[model samples]
Target: MITDGAAMGRKSVGKEYPSHGSVLGGKPNRCVIHPLQSSMVAEALERRNKDWIVRTKDATDLIVQVGDFSFHLHKLAMVSKSGYLRRLAFAERSGEENGSSLKIILEDLPGGTKSFELVVSFCYGGKIDVTATNIAPLYCAATFLEMTEDLQQGNLISKTEAFLSYLMLSSWKDTFQILKSCESVSSWSKELLIVKRCSDAIAWKACIDPKAFATLEEDEAFCLTLLANSHGNLNVEESSEKWWFEDVSTLRIDHFVQVIESIKSRGMKSELVGSCIAHWTVKWFSRITSGFDNLTPKHLAQKLQRITIESLIKMLPMEKNSVSCNFLLHLLKLGLTKQINSEALSKLERRIAFMLEECSVQDLLVKNYGSKDTTYDVGIIIRVVKTYALFALKYSEPRVCIVGRLMDGYLPLIAKDTNLTVDDFKSLAEALPTNARYSDDNLYKAMDMYLLAHPNLTEEERTNVCGAMQYHRLSQDARQHVMKNDRLPLKIVREFMLLEQVKMARSITACESNDHPRTKTRTIMKVTKGLDRGCLTPKREISMIRKEVENMKMQLDQLQTCKVKLQRQVKRCIK
Candidate 1:
């Protein structure tokens, strides 16, 4: 019988097995080695003959052959903490088949050298399953190996994949993280391309910081344009909330103009152009208006003529009337005063003529006034024209002619027939008041009356007469004479009084109706008082009293009849 300690030693020795050393028969008293043990010993002896395998204190490096293939295993880390030697021994003893088919060659990797083959697999693999838990280890390994392709491939997957991609990409700190980790130029390019293609605002924001982009001119311009275009589609209030492009205020005007011109050159569709124009107008209205307003009339005319008629029309709908009319007046004024190129002046003239014909002065005013849709009142057109004429009259002779003609066609009617007389109209027309508060309809009416009063007037005569009338101040005596003769219509006066009475009655009724609760309370109190004072009970009380009196009277009447009969009998006996 073996002692327990001796049996335990034998079993412990049996359980532990070396990966390389032979376990075959050797010395029985020394340690009875099996046949497989002898084979392992022979392999170890052969491995010792080769200089490639290194045995160190921390780990072991071995080139092992299993089947046809060979693989390297670094021994700086333990192969198995629970002991692979024990499993190998058990497999040898049980004659069980080893699951591994590929030969694994163990080679020690020094601290400086990297296992780059692992990186290649990671990069080119059909599918990579990287999670947060494993990412740090993978990233460390990738970095140590200088795995540019793998890092870039990872970045591409992170950006292109669905929600997982976004989460991973956003998890990165900055562009440098991608740059440092990636090995290939193409991989780095892919990173940039992925960032550029990112549609999520948050993802894009994470990829490219505005400050970083600002250093690259091309990138900065691209980013600004992208942001501007994006902002254009957003509601004004929503865009204001983001204010993402607020830094764009620092861009020079020329840069901004270049951006705008580039966008325009792309052939903007109506909706896009409208949105862009709206955003531009809101962002730079005062600046654009002031700058454009400062340009010489000739310069403005040249610029205006260069633009397509369609573009000009689009601009018109977006601009304030004052700004639009000012631009138009500038072109017209330039055509009259400056010696501009004939072609340019001709275009301006054609555009102006087309606009006037299409947008008739009367029709525009009536349409705008009737709809109450315009920012400026309909009267602004008259003031704008008058201002243009006055300014033109001061500078050039042709302008005077143009002004005279305009007055003949439109202003004369405004002055003579409308409430604005020739003199009051002239004062307003010459002064060109900015606030055109007076009713334009009155001006139209006055002009109509004057035209009716003077029949068969030649066009030239009418022009001169209207121009002269602009200077003619009507005398107070004449105004009084006109007023005295123009008495209010009796029917109108009677109707006015009737309307006043009806309005007063309605007001009184409304006031009384509103006080109904209080009135009803007072009325109810009076009724209740009358009821309590026996006025309501008096009817019942009087009816009862009268019934009793009637009964008494009937009884007395019967007694009286009896006494009369007795007296009658007595009289008869005496007779």
Candidate 2:
């Protein structure tokens, strides 16, 4: 119970309406006025009455003790401003009516008396001073009491905590300071649920406050603890990071799992615990596959643990283009490690096998070999092809053949691609397997284009492009053009001179061999003559000839495509 003896002290809040009829310092009421002057005095009294209902503290109902400070606040003012207070007021009304007490003790209230006083001010005048030091406590206290803004301003529900976090993200030093400070606050994620609310804010300021990571790095326990904390009433899709796990995997796995077990002993909602564990485990495994992006909301939901395999099957990518290869790899790892076992693991294996068979040949190449959009490391594309080629050698009729052809075809195009640098091509060369080298290697073609472009292969000051490709092999014509002296080998000169003698010997040998025709083999003959040669009358041979012609036409088309791509490379070199 609080004594009302502070009434006299409360009256000195501010300048008040001095006695209605008195002069300065309560001197006297002897001054008189005419009817016109009297009317003005009456109007002044009316104005004062209209304003004094809240200001005149003649009937304060509650004394809110915040730390060492006390606020003499109206019961209606506090109740209307806070849902928690309204409940307390209702419960205490009978006790107050029996004259027990008019005080509300806020034991260990967050934000101290000044911040609460600001709350009181807002209740009275709709204004409160907000600063970095006080803003956090103000928000936490408001959140604790479920205090909402005035509904007349159009807010439909009470969630001042989220709004406060949202506002905190806008400033530079403040956002970083708040994020670092809040991490050590103990059970903030489990109890306060600030992680999701502040995630985007933290990301935006990571650049501005590079040391923002120092807090988490110095305190590994804090990051792991955040992962294990159970959540409720969470907005699952609040973050749609294109690659969320890439950031989340910064947390240490062994320490994170240990922290999770400790928190689980204290009792967490099973669903939340399961979801957190599954997602974190998936992210941990994603690091090995280098496919953290495969675990984000773009591919899998956070609540995947709660969903059945049947639902997951529907959600999983049926086509190779849609396949989260890393995710399936994670499931297989989970099975082998016995992290997931029994029927679930069996089903997972089946799903993976089906995905492997149904996967798009083209898409699998892009996913593993590195495509332009998703792959960040320049050389991953090369290794992707190399690995695929290795996988093919084990099978006599291997699907790796598809990858093999693509590897050969894409090498020159990718090496000469304007998007990639010569250093990138060098990395590719380093990783490329020796056996996979011969087919359509672009290493030489790239240098040839460069040598041709500069006019004087000797003219340039040796760019990274020149330094990398200088020793690469080139064609006879390109070598002779200007880069190298035209020199014919002795063997080639001798062979050229003996061509007529070889032709005569081959003609005599052919005449002797054709003396006895064999029945085992079919020989093609050029049988056109004026009046001596006879034609082979058969539609079957005609069809075979057409088939050969068509095959040659297809080969010609592919050659033309390669020619066009080579031209584009040359243009890029000139540019």
Best-fitting candidate, scored by TM-score: 2
Compared with the true structure, what per-residue lDDT tens digits does model 1 show for residues 429-520?
44332222122333333443554555555544334333422111334333222222212222222222333333333333333445465654
lDDT of each: 0.34, 0.40
Measured against the true structure, the TM-scores of the candidates, in listed sequence, are: 0.22, 0.28
Off by over 4 Å in 1: 1-253, 271-285, 288-346, 360-575
List clashing residue pairs in candidate 2.
none
Query: Backbone clash tally for model 2?
Result: 0
Residues 275-352, candidate 2: write the lDDT tens digits.
Answer: 444565565545645855465674253233323322333334333434354455444443443333355555655554
